[model samples]
Target: MPSLLSSAIAHPARNQHLLLLQSSVAQTCLPVLRDVVQRSMERAREKTILFCLLYPPLSFLDKASRAQTDRLLVVDRTTYVPGYSDGLDFNDDVASFLRSAIMDSIQSSSLNIVIDSVDTLLSDINSVSATTRILSELLSIVRTRGGTSRLIIHVLAPCPLLPILTQTRFSPSLTHLIAHPTALLTHIASAYLTLPPPLSPPEKFWGVFIPISERHYESEKLVYGSAGEGSGLQDFVVEILVRGGADATGRRRGVERELEGWSPALGGPCEVRELDSLKSLCSEKPATEMQIVPDPTQNLPFNLNLTQEQAKSRAQVPLPYAHEGKPPVQASMPAAILYDPDSADDLDDDDPDEDLDI
Candidate 1:
């Protein structure tokens, strides 16, 4: 049986490289990224590490709720460490420890890391030079592990680093950890999901996140060169809601909050035109005659207007007389008119001739 990650990965032979990012790191590009986590959760591999970069603490909650991995370990600079008794430790040393702990956790459980906000982490790194060094070391440690653990770093920075991530490689403990970008990366990810557009028109696009291959191990790459087919793509819809720092246990309450705000599914029934139309179904009134208002918008079978003679003749016609009334009463309309002329020819001509003579 194929692993969950293998199944989630479509066409591993053609394209290789997975670049998974939070649909939104900031408020601007949410619609595109909101469903990213949900879809990612459905299509996640057991040994995959989802690195998330979020700005607000609440945002972290949302991301965590949507995509659950084997182990969820949060690393935040803003929060205090519980065990540190000395008036809450807040130093780079603690951050380093947390990073190492994360790597250790990964080793125990296939080494999957969810960095909530890489952009934020980069920003918080006291020294870009030293911080990068620390990250390099951690990534190196992760790569050296015997287990084939995949690392997904979600970087929120959009301007330069975002585009250059593929070409860029920092020295890792193991040289192969240098990440590269590919078509599979772009195909698996939807750029539209991260676009900061108006909320009214909810049009979204799908993009695939392919894994960056190691320079030496070509065959070890999950996806190859062809760019996998589109049959494996999944569609998702996402909405964001303001969670007021609630102690909610599950992801649903957060979703409910979002639904309450957006109300995406509020258009009501298509055929129901007026409140009165809905009243019939809701109230269940036993009406003797339900007046059907002619929908001018709809195509109707019967003509609305009729001449006086036509109205009188139609009024004289009995309802389904062919089925209800006596069987041989008489042939209807055209049949009566079409009857043999010889049957009525006995008396009419003689009376007409007498009138002409007078």
Candidate 2:
């Protein structure tokens, strides 16, 4: 998949922005989480604060630099539960703890709040309304402060809330997926980005960055233009390739690269009719054919050369700026006279003397 950091950077957040990164599998999101943390660390000197609600736990952050970790304030996901042995509760309010963390981060620097997975949090809380309220409050806080806060969230794809009809058969339409957890997150987010599922098993590591809203896609399309003719929304697909390697600590690391020429259309199942309609609308209009008209004077063998006198007269003619009646205003003295010390005495002599006090 494409590097989440690079994609996020490309779609820069304005002041008080919320960003969502939705995918089906939680593991697929790890690379992006690491990348964002590292980027936050690099910019920490600029007073960037990162608050991470790590559902997968602190071990996921081990690959991040010490500086990155120092800049981060994390809330263990277990704390959200009331009776869990490892849970940390203050006044029995997980909402309060989250608010406090956000406020503290804002006080120090611009906040970058990342929640590993809202779906997991919702499940833990077992109250969608309560979780939604908390999220709404946090978003409001960021907006009211007028400080640019990038709230990055990961949501599971094929969301659990999506109704399953039978064990073998599934809802094949996008309408069924609209009520997914990520969809709810989308309603509040400033930008909704999706990491589309891979095409083939071999290409499973590759994904495309797609904007959640058509309006946003249109605005971007106007600015960047279509990628190619007949390409449809696939023209805007930014391919992200996930690679595995070792960090300085010899721990297995995952990194992302932005590849070229890959289209989202090639990956995952989509509503064909909707895509077809959009393709028809966005397709480039063909150029109109027109006959070239010959210049009226092209074949005329008229005198093309000007006489010396005529040329001289043309050259001598005053330009539009040079009025015929008024002399041009001289704002400064001649270079020679201005620079010459001898001319200074002459200029002084020309000045009328005033009566001196006796």
Candidate 3:
């Protein structure tokens, strides 16, 4: 079976997605996720979002990051409630209020909603049913808007009330598989993404493996395009410039060599029907075509790029105010390294961040 990475790169303008994000925020995959959201917006030509529940350095916290922030809408439900605190009660009114706000925000254009940890709410008595109800209402609202809106919701608890679930529950024996984890995820998420737990010891540079729901195959089709006759060949080749590595010419150079050779017609306006036919041909006989090598001279070390220097200098760090002359204010450290496993076991099996007030 093809991987989620294949599916995601194939279809960027999907209407809905249910991603399993890790509780930590320091993971390097944030850049990849942001890239996906940006590309989705580019394809749809509308506003996009990254809704967060518990995490710091949220993309939309200040003016400096506001442009990126404007594209995101965050919901910090952690403060209102704490982790694993089963003492509180679910306020239907508050849940309804938040749901309305989210619906309004998504009404204007294509948006992506994310609920970081559903397990947080699982602690409250009857929390699963209540949250499921609210989320169902929110899904209805998004569907009514008629744009390509998606969601990357997270689940921390073992069992959920939704059908579109990302993580799977444990099984002691064949009998344990008799009961379903929950339908709440499926009811809200059109595609489910899961990740497996850490089985081996942590490596220096940890990477996550995600398996998106197989439903992707049934949900959409991939179209291929061809260069119009007599058009320049430059339009057929996509130039990729990575932040590192030696630059070379022709195909086997730079980062482009890392990607499997699959070039779609992306230069200009092409007939969709023709693109569809080309895709069918490729699928039937992928080896019949000759491999066109990508041009090199793209990769360069980040420290060598002046633009990168400026970015590194401006990165957020604790510094004294020019006038105060006192000590600098304490700044919180970056988020933890986390992974969102695309698997049934990654869902809400326990409520870890649901006790504090929102």
| Candidate closest to the true structure, highest lDDT | 2
lDDT of 1 by residue, 1-358 (tens): 4321222222121111222333321112232233333343343332333333354334534665634434444444444334543343324443554565565454463444444445555555444555455555545554554343334445543423343333335421110111122222222233323221222222331111112111213312323434432211122212222221112232221211111111113321111112231223224334654565567845768778789999999999978643464355455634433233566566554555665756
Give the alpha-carbon lDDT of every model.
0.34, 0.42, 0.35
Clashes of 3: 40
Q: RMSD, each candidate, Å?
A: 19.9, 20.9, 32.7
| Per-model TM values vs. the true structure | 0.32, 0.39, 0.34
lDDT of 2: 0.42
Model 1 poorest ten-residue lDDT run? 255-264
Off by over 4 Å in 2: 1-11, 45-60, 63-70, 78-82, 89-109, 160-358
Residue-pair clashes, model 2? 6
After TM-score superposition, what is the CA distance of residue 2 in candidate 1 from its true location, in Å? 11
Estimate the TM-score for candidate 3: 0.34
lDDT of 2 by residue, 1-358 (tens): 3233343533233341454544432113444445555565566422333333444445345644543544555555444454655544322443555466555554555655566676776666677667666655555654454444555555555444322211112211111011111221223222333222322222332321233322233433433445412222232222332233232345653443432222245442232212432333323345552355566766667976689999999999978753457555577845433233564465555536555554
**Whole-model lDDT for model 3 versus the true structure?**
0.35
Ranking by lDDT: 2, 3, 1
